[model samples]
Every structure is written in C-alpha cells, then in structure tokens.
Target: MTHPIPIFIGVDPRERAATNVLIDSLTQNSSVPLAITPMVTPQLEKQGLYWRDRDPKQATAFSFSRFLVPKLMGYQGWAIFMDCDMLARGDIAELWALRDDQHAVMCVQHMHEPNDTVKFLGEPQTPYPKKNWSSLMLLNCSRCRALTPEYINRATGLELHRFHWLAGDHEIGEIPGGWNHLVAVQDPAKAEESPLLHWTLGGPWFREQRTMGEGLAAEWFAARDDAFRLWD
Candidate 1:
C-alpha cells in the first residue's frame, strides 16, 4: 500500500468553515491516505512560528503560512501545500501520484491580473509575477531548504510569492491547469475540467458573493452540501 501524502493547507481563522469544506472535498475524493494539516495562526504560534512578526499588517492571514509547509515537513522528502479556499473536483491521489524529483516544486503556472482592486475583507488585491502559483504546490521538501522558519520570518510576502526562494524560474515544474482553476478568471467550460477549484476572492462563506449566485459557485455549493450531508 502507498503511504499517505502529507498535505498542509493554509487556513485563516476567519475562514475556518470554508477550510473545513475544502478538507472534506479532498478527503471525499481521494482513495489514497492523506496526512492533512491546517496551518492556522494560533497553531503556528504554539509551534514557535510567530507569523505576525513577519507581516505586521496582516494583509493576508495565510500569506506566509504557505512557506512554512516545507519546513513543517522537516525539509525531507516531498509534500503538498494548498490554500484553504479550494475545492477538489477530482481525485487528489492523482495529483499526489505526480512526483518529479528534478524540481524543488511543482505548481500550476498562472499569468493572471486582478479584476477587482480589493480582496474578500477589502484588502488590496495585489498582483505580481507568477500569481496564484503558490496557491497549490507539490513541494520537493529536501530541495526547499530556503523555506526555513528563520527565512520565512524575515522574507517579505512579495519575495515569497514572486518565486524568489528558488535560484530561477526553471526550478519550478508545471502542473496541469485543471489542478487549479481560478473561479471567475477561467472560462466556464474549461474550468469544469479542472480537478481543483480555487475561490481566490471569497467562497460561499462570503454572504454577498453567495447571494450574487455566480454559476461557477454551484460546484462549490454541491461540494459543501455533500461535505455536510451528515450534519444536515
């Protein structure tokens, strides 16, 4: 039997419910075992990772947490990191099956621009090179020594998100776009084919956005319903 994959998810306390839904989607679809960990601020604090010292502004709650994934795995073997606001539409085991020892990290490369000026909590929607690339990553932990707690505690968000940790762009392996379909940014038909759906702006938890009733949201809603079927 294959060993369970270690998957760390960036979770903000404000979006705990959404994070839970994301977890449900991952667990429900994957046949392979998974060791899932949610990186929340309080938990990080207990682990001696004071994230706020790095981003005093707290612009994005989980902005720096993604960097901690490699370190959390003890800089050994391979692991995966994903944002909490994502839903899996396909087998996560398939994504786990992909492991290229050649690269330090594997991610869906996205050339994206923001349609809005602000994010879910009215924070500025900052765009930079290789946007959304870090949202979902297949990390080769041994090669990701640069993501140490000391380094992450001092590095700026821009430095982390802009692929500065690696020696160059070539170090990053590309994954299929279907692994990270950005809602609203992608074409509806094409998005349907994606195994992973990222609600970058705000998911169903956002009252106003939920009421707006975007067509792409139906999948998330369905996943949410299935996730909570026992409770309902």
Candidate 2:
C-alpha cells in the first residue's frame, strides 16, 4: 500500500476555528491520502520546542513553528507546510504532483506589497522582501538540513526567510501563484482562479472582519460549519 502524504500546518493556537476549517477544506478536496498534522504551540512546547515569536510584527502560533516541519519529518521524505488561514479549492494531489526533487524548497514567489496598513489582530503590516513565501512550502526535507532545531531557534526572521540558510537563490524553486493566492492583494479576477485562498491578513471568521470582502468567505464559513459538526 502507498503511504499517505505528510502535511504539517502552522496553526495559531488562538485561531482554532480557522485552522479546523482549513483542515476541513483540505479533506474535502484532496484526492490523495494525507497525514495532516497541525503543529500547535502547546504541543511544540510540550516537546521542549518553545514558540519563539520574538518579532513584534509576528504572533501566529506557527509564525516560527513552520521551520520545525522538516526537522519533525526527520529530514526524510518530502512534506508540505502550510499556514492555517488557507482554504483549498483544488485537489492537494495536484500541488503534490508538482514537486521536483532538484530544489530544497518550493513556494510561490509572491511579488507585491500588502495594501492594508494592519494585518490580523491589528499587527503592523511590515512589508519585507519575499513576504508570504514561507507561508506555504513544499519541503524536500532530505536536502533541508539547515532547518534544524538549533538553527531555527536562534535565527532571525530575515535569516530564515531570505534564503540565508540555503547555499543560494538557485536552491529555492518557484511554484504557481494560484497555489498561494493572497486575499485582498491579488486582482479580484485573478483571486477567483486561485486554487488556494490564503487569508494573509485576516479572514471572515473574526467578528470585526465579517464585513471584509474575501470573495471566498462563503466557502470558508461552509467549511467551518462542517468542521464544527465533526467536533460536536
């Protein structure tokens, strides 16, 4: 029998609702088998890996937890790491099928600044180079020895995200933009075609964000309701 694909998601402990709904969306659309692991803060803490969210601009439970994905996989086979605020409209198998072994990591190279002044929970929208590239990654773990616990524990956000750990930019590969389409940033027409909808700033689940036009909020709500039923 074929083994299921391993997917590690970075879920902020505070955003359980969004995380669960993201899981539901993946399950609803994925054609391939998956071993979904939500890398919660408490669980990582229990394992002696603290959530070192030292940056004032970042506070998501998995803001830094995503770096642990490769280490957790024992630097073995390929694994996918995604932010919890994403909703999948296309089959995950399609994304998985795009994997190439030549590169250490693969993600959409989003190339624009965020329009908003603040992000979810009013965090300052600090725009840096290669923003959101780390939000969704297809890791070739065997070649990703640099993401070790010790390195990730002390590295600054820039060092971790700016391809400092890798040999050079060529080691990083690119994926299609539709796979990590950012909400509120992409052209409305293009956003509609994206297979993955990422609420990089925030989503409709928040009471204060209900009026925000996600264009795909309905799908998130429907998925959230489905996830709620499973837990009930």
Model 2 residue runs over 4 Å out of place are 51-53, 229-232
Question: What would the per-residue lDDT of candidate 1 be over residues 139-208, giving only the tens digit for each residue?
Answer: 9999999888888878888888887999998899999899998887777687757898888877777776
| For model 1, the run of ten residues with the poorest summed lDDT | 50-59
lDDT of each: 0.83, 0.83
TM-score of candidate 2 against the unseen true structure: 0.93
Clash pairs, model 2 backbone: none
Give the TM-score comparing model 1 with the true structure, all chains together: 0.93
lDDT of 2 by residue, 1-232 (tens): 6578899989876677888888878888888788999898788878976646557766576777688888899999999999988888889989998899999999999886776678878877867788889999999999999888888878887788776899898988999999998887777688777899888878887887764545477767877777677552
Error of 2 at 127 (Å): 1.1
